[model samples]
Target: MKMIKTSMLTSVIFSFLWVSGGTALAEEPNLEAESAILVDAETGKIIYDDEIDVILPPASMTKIMTEYLVNEAVKSGKIAWDDEVKISDTVRELSLETNLSNVPLRQDETYTVKELYEAMAIYSANGATIALAEHVAGSEGEFVKLMNEKAKEIGMENYKFVNSTGLNNKSMDGQHPKGTKADEENMMSARATATLAYHLLKEYPETLETTSIRAKTFKEGTEDYIDMQNWNWMLPGSVFAYEGVDGLKTGYTDMAGNAFTGTAERDGMRFISVVMRTDSREARFKETAKLLDYGFDTFTYEKVIEKGESVKGKKALPVSKGKEDAVTVAAGHTLSVLVEKDQKEKMTPVVTLNKKYFNEDGELIAPLKKGQAVGLITIENDKDDEYLQEEMRENVKVPLVIQEDVEKAGWFSLSLRSIGGFFGEMWSGAASFVKELF
Candidate 1:
């Protein structure tokens, strides 16, 4: 089956490899889920979309925010991997609930931050999730604030977080954290979830290091050890394994059904996909695969511009009071966007100069250093392709820089040029006057 999938992707991408004129390869996928979206991980391009903004329960996928915060805390030096997190009454009680996904935690013992994180990441352990949340925020309630704050920061719309764990509050054994009510669960739109995952991967790429572990032994060498299995079936060696698939979260609940935020890389391209409320685990994975297939099959990753390449009519920036009238400029770096085979031509550069380097007349001041950042050039789609996140539009822009130095003109040189300019203007007026007289 894996071979078949690989074969199919190659055939589809190959047929359209040379396609031109911005022809889209196929219709958007008919995903069997309440909402879905597919995005280019690096370019933030919305390759496909469905009812992506409908808010719904995300089940264990809420742990994504938890994972992101833990990694962020470690990075910020606020926490340590070896930091010990003691089991709280709430965590211990939740761990004892056999009905939920978890590896039991002993009240008399404590675990390292890394151990609990792996359990939550790989096993969807509700208890471990709450433990890590408390460790980070002093309480799960405070963690929820951080979660929503981060949501707004990332531009997530139609999202809510009543608790750190995605479990329905009523099922928190009546121990739901403060500031929330019974029966409330974490909720997010498909777009919101994708946006969250996108930022998580981009900001904390080391997150993949943990999420990629298919199976691990929690508390490995002790009497409390439990072997935890990853819930993401699309992970390598799993039943629904897809090549290049790694490091993401999955979800399931009576209300949520089956949901997944999946990412995979092949060649130089990586794609992120979200499928919400599918009928079953199998359906979710299969739908996610279909979403990924569309990204890989339909879109081509082409370098639209090369570093230091000149754009038409943008070869240089005008200078004021300089030995040379202008300084040479070019793209500070190459810019690439995920484009349909034919859509490559439709992406155009929008260059906006940085005003700090310029005067009121919009000319660069003389004495500018070579390779100074002067502005940014963004690649915009002429076809009005809607990006999943507004920020994606901004991600494709490359910094613009000066290619050479333009020394300030000396006082004598300035005077000479001013006189030359005055004479040049007089000659232009004389020519016009002569033409009128004739």
Candidate 2:
């Protein structure tokens, strides 16, 4: 998995680029929000951001991690979507603990796993989340451990979990306290939340089905049905305008005001954006729109190299003692780039062919075996030198592999080839020595 460095567009250059699209670069909007980030979901590339790593409360966006663990369990067959779940006393107990968001439930009310999942994803229901926590791990404390473990698995190093729900140590009496409570606040960086959300989308697509639902009704043997509407207002109304805006989650608190983690796919390009602690709900939407607009308009997603396509301009490598003359070499995976529209003309893929095979002459050969090491191709743009040096440089190299198998020659053929190679090496050395002597 090659991490390609992307060219960064400066504000000055970005202004010029926006004119090409006919939209006067809007005043660099004031995003006084506490934390913000935008990422290309497919490539896990940070397209835009501000204070991304500063620790902050995630609010309901914490549910993304909860959804991640549950979805993973489902995919691994440890949990079934239709499996029945009983609302244990712990679930009811937690519901009492948090009243801001919940699907009111009575003791002994039973619901299916899928229904609870929907409530948690669509409504950010605290009760449903606690219910899931208890069902999956027998206790919220154990579930918090799993949450931290999953975070470590995904390289979210700066994050720690004290609870599955994103509740930091708010004084039970509204009094300011010190010590771990100061840092013990359950929190995730803007970057971490976005990264976790990106991983969830890649690994468990079913979350989208639940997260995107506008509203759902749950009837768990209760007299009244609890209908919950999705908090992400970008679905159709109540927020910033963008086509194809599906879902994600929304979060809010006195400390973290009107936060939102959102995703929308347009023209096959999916973007994940997060804004935390905005002054109001509208600001969150407007800032997210600005960030997303910058991402979609400034850069175009392109498939630079298709998987299994032979690396252009690379010659067949020599394979030593192989039956075949040469091996076909190609990229093992697709190489895609998100670059400024203007820079596309100057982009080129630089290929580094690996010497993985040999010919009868004791020289390197190609037409290598399937999955055999071939080389790497680095895609680069002439523009944005700073970005090229920083973010895009690491992703420059991608694995090149043999496109197909190269069979070794028969025993007699091998014997003959081996002898020929020995003479070839000897003659080459003698010729080199003679040239030096002359």
TM-score of 1: 0.91
Model 2 TM: 0.79
Encode model 1's per-residue lDDT on 53-95: one tens digit a residue.
8999998889999998999999999999999998888888889
Report lDDT (CA) for all predictions. 0.87, 0.72
| Best lDDT among the predictions, by candidate number | 1
Candidate 1 wrong stretches, greater than 4 Å: 1-24, 354-362, 380-383, 428-438
Alpha-carbon deviation at 350 in model 1, angstroms: 4.4
lDDT at position 125, candidate 2: 79
Model 1: number of clashes?
3
